[model samples]
Target: MFTKRAFLTLLAICIGGGTAYAQSDPLPSWNDGAVKKSITEFVAKVTTQGGPDYVPPAERIAVFDNDGTLWCEQPIYFEAAFALDRVKAMAAQHLEWKQQQPFKAFLAGDKKALAEQGEKGLLTLVAAAHSGMTTDEFAKSVADWLATAKHPRFNRPYNDLIYQPMVELLAYLRANGFKTFIVSGGGVEFMRVWAEKAYGIPPEQVVGSSGVTQFRLDAAGKPSLLKTAKVQFIDDGPGKPAGINMIIGRRPILAFGNSDGDHQMLQWTMAGSGARFAGIVHHTDAAREYAYDRPSKIGQLDKAWEEAKAKGWTVVDMKQDWKKVFAFEP
Candidate 1:
């Protein structure tokens, strides 16, 4: 009983509305796969009122690893590269560094020699490079470094390497009444300087390996804390859950990570009584992003990868699960 013109106009409106509804996905960067479906379904079940899995808004805590999980940790950890640069910058001040073992090896670009020093050597590099500055000064130094530093392979600012799908996932979770925290192995003060801008997580919400700090009155009578070489805590592997317990005081209902370092955190989250979610971001996109696991020194995913399947954790294949990797196109 309608005119041909009216019928055509009605069809256009219906199609347009349908298209808008379809495109309103919160996690647009994630592909329509089981990985994405799992995240949404978990959030839905926990949030639905009167559902058996319903969680109070205050209990919806989610934790994420920073280095390889939120951003990139390929080739080497970004902070390690920063320490190397610091060594180069300070070489001029300490002429005797040329004779120092690890410093000499680092300055001469002899990576093989540096590797022989192992974790102890790397800690020495970090202590020499990162300490001897006040907390405020160190924070400023970190901000300055991040502003200019670029990933060697990507040739983009380090902050720009954040995974788009993961960013979307963070926002989506926050919108669903979840409190997100960054539990990283990187320095806590270093991450706090820019985490709010990078991941929308505040300084107090970041828990990472920390060094001892000494509070003293400066010449001007202003109180300041100077970072010392002594280590306070190392928040990786088993330390992750311990750090979460100490910092957050409550076990998270959901946890996301990328390497074996996160295995314990995921385990702790899964061990919780209520509805829980654990996810691992498997780095498989060799073309778009660097891929190395188990055999590699940095960000090894072997044990976690094996346990993920057994424990029913969502292992996100970067190449297949994500429609895109970095927020910016390669």
Candidate 2:
């Protein structure tokens, strides 16, 4: 009974403007261009009553990828940068890692050495430093590190590298009754710990990769999940749809990402019968954020480029679309 026509009608019905009133500019800092237009149009459609493209408030599920979509991901992912730092800091305690391939590469102060290990090596490094601690412990460590670690280029806290446009988009969507979620390849616990503080998205709204975790009753008689080497979920590529299916249950009307890992997420969002939207945040502003796509090893923007065009997904070229990179980057 759920036909495309019914979905499209619902989409049209849910695109009406809500009762939100802005004292100043609704999106004051947003650049006056396609990013703003697309966002405004989407909001209007979803919030305007009697509009042909209106979508229901409850059905306005908009999911966004964390790294390059919401913030900078190069020269490498922020989490990867954290992982590298962790390897170096903990290297003193784990002397065995000093002789290891990726860890040795990490310890020797050569990023390329770990590159030689490729994906498997990177995963090994992530698991080694990221696991072995309770989820809260890992979160606290991340919070502690982010409090001091500065970007190599911008000399600002890693958390400060988030994109302003995306931030506005998140606020705008939520203001219009769109329930936003972060569906990323980054560790679920890793992002869940801080996303709410920074992006206003709660831990329950975040879905991402996670290593296996064991349930244990602690000294205080509390149950918690302990991180382990065993991979619980990858949460990338096709796994994105799987995660959304499992966690959210309902398909999203909109999805945003920046690389091949997000292709399946875009595909899944577009496949649903409705006024669905998919956008790829192309990293084309080296000055503002970063500009390496096909050649970049981490969060590479290759196939997603093709998929964006072929599927008619909105491709956000940072160089042209965004006037600002971060909230405080003035």
Candidate 3:
């Protein structure tokens, strides 16, 4: 027979042991499925000391695409929405915008017409909305936009739509010595303002599309960096790999993306020597999130989906693999 104190100690140990086991799951929002299994197994194999698949802490870099992989990007990209809002706000000053092709279409709420203008029209909108201001001014505008902008369907702030499983995965990877980065096709300065707070990735670790900037002195002789309309880097598709090479200087061991734009980045990551992990977040949950792939102009997943199948990369089925999508309750 055990004494009362000994019984209490045994009970405490059992409860503590159970709690430890329960809390061991790093990705609670991820269902117990192949996607979760593959991620955990890969981490375990790479992290094990003296194991064949062990990767050095210095080389443990993971790169993620921002728009559709980590966050929801349905209806239109968050950045695109921001540009439209900016166009509206500035339309008063530049009344000529109401008569222009792309701006006119966007202002008139003509989605089809805007899409017909294609990439050229989109760039025009971006340049008009993003340029002609100091970088500091641009940053402030972006911050202000993000503070008030809400997704159309969800009615929640864009940041709240970030995938919970991916967030957990990022944290888990960081805890295991992986340096995570956001390699987005969005504007560099725009993301730099909030990426750290939103994703735990510092501004220095973010590589994105950019416009040219030049140092200048204002009327008051205050030094400032002015954003220009000239195109600098696109940071999409082939440019994704180029941006990684130029900015990060190291090939990532792991890459996560959701569309064709991220194809080359995934290819570049897997082409490196050693064990690599490449994942594509397939948006299959129509009920929880919008599902679009081949025909969708925004975040199209067609080419990358086929490539992922051929290359044996992990394809995360959002509907089947995740117990929850957003971090917040609906």
Q: Judged by lDDT against the true structure, how good is candidate 3?
A: 0.90
Worst 10 residues of 2 by lDDT: 16-25
lDDT of 3 by residue, 6-94 (tens): 88886886765344453578788899988899899989888999999999998899999999998888888889899878988888998
lDDT of 2 by residue, 38-98 (tens): 7677778768888888888989999999988998877677888888788778888898987
The regions of model 1 sitting more than 4 angstroms off are: 1-23
- lDDT, residue 290, model 3: 80
Per-model TM values vs. the true structure:
0.92, 0.87, 0.90
lDDT (0 to 1) per candidate: 0.90, 0.84, 0.90
* lDDT of prediction 2: 0.84
Candidates in descending lDDT order: 3, 1, 2
Off by over 4 Å in 2: 1-24, 110-116, 218-223
Q: How much is the lDDT of residue 97 in candidate 1? A: 86
Write the residue-wise lDDT of candidate 1 on 1-330 in tens digits.
Answer: 799998887787676444444337878888998999999999999999999999998999999999889999978888888888887888899999899888888889899998898889888988887788899988888888888888898888888988888888888888889999999999999899988998889999999999999998988899999999999999999999999999999999999999999999999999989899999998888998977778878898989889999878999998999899897883
lDDT of 2 at 280: 89
